[model samples]
Target: MMPLRNPKHAPAAAAHLSRSAGVRHQGTKRSLSAQRSPAAQRAAPLNLEIEQLREKGNAAFKAGSYSIALQHYQEAQGKALTCRPVDDDLQARILSNCAAAQLHLGQPQAALQSCKRALQAVPNHTRALGRAVTCHLRMGGFSAAQGFIDALRAQPLTQAEANTCQQSKDALQALVQQALARAAKAATAEEGVQALAALEACLEDSHAPCMPSLLLTKADLLLLLDRHQDATRMVLAASEAAGWPQERLERYSKWVHAHMLYSQGQLDKAATAVSEMAEAAADDECRPAPALLPSRSAFAMLQQAEPQAFRDLAQSLTMLHQAKEEGNNAWRRQDKAAALNFYTHALEGITAPPPVFAAVVFASRAAVHRADGRLLDALADSLRSLALCPLYMRGVLRLGQLLTDMGRHELAAQELGALQKEQAAAARAHAVNATCIDLWRDVDAALKKAKEGQRQRRAIDHFEVLGVPRTLCTDDEVKKAYRQLVLKFHPDKALGRCRFSSAIHTTCRPSLAQSQLEERVRAQAHRVFSMISDASTALATRSSRITLEAQLNVAQYRTASQQQPYSPGRYSGAYQPRSSTARASRQNAYSKTYSNDYYDSDYYAYERFWAS
Candidate 1:
């Protein structure tokens, strides 16, 4: 028989069932004399059919068709229950498989009930016990799970089973540790107490190795709540369980004593005792780790007890700096996700914003954003970092590089050019160092590349820029297209510039400082406006138009020869076919009335004609 809940046996079972089905369809019934017994004959076909359904369910589960797999398991179980003198082992296996499918579908409670039913059929089912332990752990019933875990341990198990059970335990501990940490950071006492109670409920089973961490967390919470005696007791118990020596226990004892004195309004005595503890903690062997001291909550209490001893601003900055270093290390390890989280923590940890540190972390996060293909977010972060610390060299370089990659050559050039001037000023003020010289070279190289991109952009086809056909356009058409483009792209009329100007007039009111982003957008609009003007000039006049037309024909013919057969399209510069009657009528009308007023009248009439 196939192993319980094993999908690997599916193909062989399917093949065997197919052969049997084919024989049954061929009317190969056993003679009465050849049959074993009436009961065996009556039960034989039902058992075979149930096995076939179970195998089908296994195949579906392996194929990731979990809903279909679940339906098959339920149908197989239903059929199995209908048989007289039921096959207990087969029923247990089917129920266990149903549990596995339920678990995969994220129905933990349902899966747990299925496991119970399976175990009811066969009391010592190993697979059912293992799955039940998992369901209980997932539902945060760790104490309830202990019974299943012990039962599974009592059974002889294979190496795979042991490894899986160990992994589940590890996962549970990690989850509990995370929960306790969150409780420690809870904003209100009521919230923290509730969180702690939930954690305690889940952790009633002493077999979990994470109990020491939990005890320490509870001590920290109790201390914050001014339950001095309970906090001290928890600290002592946690210290012993965590294998802390005499020195660490004494330090926490002193801290708890000082906290108690502070809570009872003996401020002077609390100050003296805290000073003594601090002096003792200065000794290298006696120093406690910052996390172990649980100072964030106590630090708040101490502010009222001893104002001169702790500065909140300095403490917050120290924590943010540590987070920044961790972020840098994660970035070095190429773990962008971890690096992003650490940088965000540093940003949020500050009590008073430190410009330099904030700028550095923002710039580092921008680098991660760039690596993850979030170019717009990278651009925003880079600009924000530069706005915070204008002279931050790395931030300037990053923003310039980003602009260049986005084909905003004019903006890239401006950024790099400013850096070049700064580098030159520094070199003149002092002896030129290697670092300064290297930065100068990078700025110079980036500026040159940006200028090259600008030149390339200018060299693109004028007809393409104005959205007019070189082969079919007349002088009037060229002028009209140029006017429309100028209206669309002019700095004064541009969409972004208009919106910003509106804001300045309304809610923004008058302010001495303008947003850096608005300035960049205005500059970009002016650059595009200038490019359009230059393109218009290059295509103006009769001689210029004829020269452009001849040049375009040669380029198009050469391109068409090397590529696929060209059709009459924009790039090919070929004219679309025109009707002879329409061309003749247009020519006759133009010849008879060729005046500016006549053209203006026709234009307005055509506009009115379209409106109707």
Candidate 2:
């Protein structure tokens, strides 16, 4: 060997080696690579470059610069792999350091890969094994973590490393305990799917054989989920599935057997069956640390109390079914009377039957009544049915028919149209198997006809209410009329000055009825004041005034079509003015002047209090 030259050449190799040759490698009497082959000598740094890189990586890692630390570690790992001996402690240390950085960076999967390579180089590498355990735990690979933890613990460790091993074991145990607790909670919460999922998740992970305890819990949770067969398969192991050892299988059998007995409705037998198992588990110091089963007295109380609830529920259900059967039979035979009676009985039988069943009875009775041509009764029942279940297709169909029978075709069609959307949504969500296409087609046809036949209700004439001419009014005219009316009727003006007639003291000189009458008059005055306020609001703006004018024209046209022509001349001698403004002023004085008219005192008395 020609005394292998340093692989790295500085600006001046001779000067660099002269200074560093003794200083960097000074502690060693003989170089660790003194007798290495030329290839081995060239593969690693001769000076201290790798140590420098590790120092920089540590600094970056400690500074919360995870990404920078990761880059530094990766570079160190690359150099060590390519430049150092394959099985050197330095090679394992660099790879394990890379894994620690990766773990902290939230790249546990990547960290596992690095740890595996480190372990390959040095099988007893405690740091690498511990890092691998952490990575597995991070990824929910409890089985894989257990293997690393066990392997790590098997190796000789310093006091600190031993503590690390203990901590790792405790962490893995805590994970097992938490998963079990969560599974138990989910089961008790009646979240069956989630409970089964939690069990299947733990059972499927073969590498992280958390403990015999988790597997036992899986069997119990499976039973709780009503998965008798899966519970059996999990505990006994299927033909195609890998089985647990015989001793372990025996430990799982106690819970599985008790679950089977429980499934047969043998509550007492099930409770007794699991008692020994729980006791034995507690004896073994198993986690979550088993608690004793409920005592016999608790079981007795449950057994005593459960029957009354079950009987009440069963009786109601049975009576409802009986009523429904009678209705169905009567309906099929065209006995509308009998069917109506039976359906009514079914509807009234339960105080609160399930909404679905109640809706069915209501709709069924409505259909019977519809066939009998009692449209009002049918409408009542159909409305009740829809109230119970807005999405009840039968109720929707019946309600539309009932409404159509009642000559409310537009409302009938609108209601059915709304149901069409609900049906389509139900079908899309897979909540209903029947497609809504046919129903929508029928509803759309009905809606088109109903729209054409729809009676356009005339808008209430605010112009008449405010005593203004429909066509002659300007914004100022409307506002002026509104102000005069509100002034006459405003509760504030009438509150203290108003007088009550003797007729208001109906039963006595001043009885309870008289007080009530006084309050009623005050209420009436407030209401008239509100109406005057509403009139003001209606004509407050130009757009609103225009809308009011159009409404008054339509109302007048409708009134003219329905009645004989009004005679302005016939009422002229009795005195009505041309302009509504002049006419409105007379009407405003009508209330105040006639406040003393005293005609049909019983009827005219309350009017003297407001409306000027």
TM-score: which candidate is best?
2
- TM-score for model 2? 0.31
Q: Candidate 2 residues 1-612, lDDT tens each?
A: 011122111112222322321223232234545523456555645326767888898898778776787788778767766654542566677787787776665455666788888877777665676667655644445556546645644343357644654565466556556666665555232454575566556544422332334454554455555465776664553211122334434444544554455333333444455444434443232222232111111111112222343344334445656787899999999999999889877666533333446666778887887787655446555655565456667678877865655445667778877877776787789774435566566666666545543555434345545667654466788878877776666656532323322111011111112244345435645655665566667766655655555454554555465577777676566543356565568456644534334233332332332222
Q: Let me know the TM-score candidate 1 reaches against the reference structure.
A: 0.29
Candidate 1: RMSD over Cα atoms? 28.2
Give a tens-digit lDDT track for model 1, residues 41-64: 455455788888999999999998
For model 1, the run of ten residues with the poorest summed lDDT: 502-511
Cα TM-score per model: 0.29, 0.31
- The lDDT per prediction is 0.60, 0.53
Number of clashing pairs, model 2? Answer: 7
What's the CA error at residue 405 for candidate 1, in Å?
1.0
Off by over 4 Å in 1: 1-313, 350-352, 458-612
